[model samples]
Target: MGRSPCCEKAHTNKGAWTKEEDQRLVAYINAHGEGCWRSLPKAAGLLRCGKSCRLRWINYLRPDLKRGNFTEEEDALIIHLHALLGNKWSLIAGRLPGRTDNEIKNHWNTHIKRKLLSKGVDPITHRPIDATDCERSEEKKAPRCPDLNLELCMDLPIEMQQEPECSVVPSSTTFLLLDYCRTSLQMN
Candidate 1:
């Protein structure tokens, strides 16, 4: 059933790869190139299982991966993309070159999720950064005089009234607004 299993029986060898093993796997891939991972170990003369070799190459050895802390811009992009795409980490990773799905997923859960939450926004809904108990900021204030009706609005203090109403506006606008707000507030 299920072709037995992808990895070999346990306790044989696994986890925390070493330098020499890394070199052999890397060299083998470079020389012959990856096709069938099942055959890769035999060709590479490594004791590790084929699945292990594949995981190491994809998750670690790949040249395209971007190592180190994600820059501010990248983090901002990830947040925006995550908002639009949800927990689809692979798709998010696709948008940002050199970033891995696992890396992106980890960054999302560990960093971005908490950051969004700290700002009082629901990461999933991308709603206003308010506490969990806080109700929605009320339906869009009926758009203050609907079209500004300058002729009809002149009698009332439109500027004063409109300013406060707008200030109470919900942040359910663009995905980039929070990021922009974060940058502006931080810079100030």
Candidate 2:
């Protein structure tokens, strides 16, 4: 069977919450602390849904929230974190104390995107907006083989040999080494 609805939609109030509603919600929360959100609206005597109450408290009325414009430092930190973490707003918000994931997400969409564009940075890829087509294609292409350096130098024991010698092994020699190891393992 399907799950039940969170609340009686017909009976619940919608649209903007009034100052009185905010006050009542705050008062209820302050007195009892934030308990089960599913029961909070009923316990607080609110005509709103639990989700609405939780959002209102978390995004608006929370005491520890940093109200006002984000600082320059915060902007840089958000941009840096966004580049490192991509669209993981909750993880980004964790790095910025007193900022909510919703708030950061909104700020990114409304402000940071424009700011990055103005600075010639692609907000999504975090790459230079003016990058050449060749550069862009390079990102899409498969990785090339890495250069292999197989130089070896060894000193022989006094009774066995003369001076130390250095030799450069070919890249193909790596396959031989692997085959030798496999054969030695099988023998053992």
Candidate 1 similarity to native, TM-score: 0.67
On TM-score, the candidate that comes out on top is: 2
In the range 113-139, model 1's lDDT, one tens digit per residue, is: 898888877787776655332332233
lDDT tens digits, residue span 1-188, model 2: 99778899999999999999999999999999998888999998999999999999999998989998999999999999998888999999999989999999999999999999999988977777766745644543422222223334344552343433444455677677656666766776
lDDT of each: 0.74, 0.82
Which residue ranges in model 2 land beyond 4 Å of their true spot? Answer: 134-188
Total backbone clashes of model 1? 3
